[model samples]
Target: MMACAGGQPGTDAERPVLFSVVTEPIVCCPNDPDDAKTLSDVAGAKIDEVFIGSCMTNIGHFRAASKLLEGKKDMPVKLWMAPPTKMDAKQLTEEGHYGVFGAAGARMEMPGCSLCMGNQAQVKEGATVMSTSTRNFPNRLGRGLLVFSAISDGTQS
Candidate 1:
């Protein structure tokens, strides 16, 4: 596996580079009726996955998704929550937010480098994954994988 040293930049030959973009905060879900008409209006496309984890996604993120799915219940997108630490997962579950996520078809994973490491229990080959992780490189997680950086507003694959 390719690994980057602390603050050390890798050359183009050494690194398997991937395209990425910085997007505006996702104030609402992409499927929300009031949001932008298309992804182009909010951000570019070619997204693979939608991640709802990492240190940046706080309780508020879950709350927002939960609220968005309230009453409607059956959310259309597939959401994966990977908290930065075990503590965060416990807090979310203890606070009864897990049910909300579950109701909306979201999966709460253990707090560790699971999917981000390219070792998810069920990722298919040639899958394009959108993530909140900091890096976007080839084979960083899975062989022939395509990874995309996530926006703050919760928009994901």
Candidate 2:
């Protein structure tokens, strides 16, 4: 999880910090390369959705996803990437990172809490979602929505 500027808790007077949270590979994890062996091992799996934009998902996330999808164009994962701010989105797009994600069959969205907030677009009931946002609680985004923090680079979750 790459923590970018924006989405920090504070007012305009507060300073922002950039950091990333990575986690070690857990045994029996579905996305674990040691267990899966190939992208097809997880392709077309039951994934409710994927939220790729947030303080946890920076350019590194895009690059990782791109590499994962390399030579596996038919991956079956519904991906929605939302940069923490419009500026991040613009810079990423300008740098051609957006194309990398798109080539991997991921959709790019505007910067905002599109799914993290129950009021915004809500996740389907009992749907399994992977996100880069912090916190995972009942009805935090929607009732019974299973939200998992995406671990990137086999270090951050």
Candidate 3:
């Protein structure tokens, strides 16, 4: 299983339940993590913005994103990138990932909780966003935002 969950020990739901058998990467729909679907499910869907950051993401994720965006310029959607820490940002800069992000017209956010907590940066109102944030509850990031949460590779940011 790609994801799993279980209740507390000595309770009625002690055994872990298989959450999903994801053969490939999956993404959660807006406002509902349980409403998971494969990337193909959202094919041809309009994405107004893309966010590849927050606490849930790691250096590897950013590296993968950079690799995908290598030599690309003028991204179709508004792309936001933020590493989990200043150290990650530094490493990506040293590795030239920052240049890739810039070439793609991605907005480089501060290294920490950029758009995940709804505190630092926020997407456009009523925008459809593909994100790596941990959650996609209503109004968490912005008013009337439709946030689809997924791993970096799944979203292909």
**Highest-scoring model, TM-score:** 3
In model 3, the Cα lDDT at residue 10 comes to 72
Q: 1-157, model 3: which lDDT tens digit per residue?
A: 3333234557764544454544665788887765676789877778999988887788888898889999998778999888999999999999999999998889999999978877887889999999988888898878899889885433333
Candidate 1 lDDT over 1-157, as tens digits, reads 2333222365443433122432433222222212212235546555555666665566666666667766566554456777767776787789777787787677778776666665664345566666665555566545675555544543331
lDDT of predicted model 2: 0.57
Give the per-residue lDDT digits (tens) of candidate 2, residues 1-157: 2322223346553333223332232111222212211234434556767777656566666666666765555456577777777777787779777777777777676677666565556667777776666545566656776566544443332
- Model 3, CA-based lDDT: 0.82
What local lDDT does model 2 show for residue 15? Answer: 35
Clashing pairs in 2: 21-156, 22-155, 22-156, 23-155, 23-156, 53-82
| Strongest candidate by lDDT | 3
Which stretches of model 2 miss by more than 4 angstroms? Answer: 1-23, 26-46, 70-72, 151-157
* Candidate 3 residue runs with Cα over 4 Å from true position: 1-21, 152-157
Ranking by lDDT: 3, 2, 1
Error of 2 at 62 (Å): 2.5
TM-score of each: 0.59, 0.59, 0.83
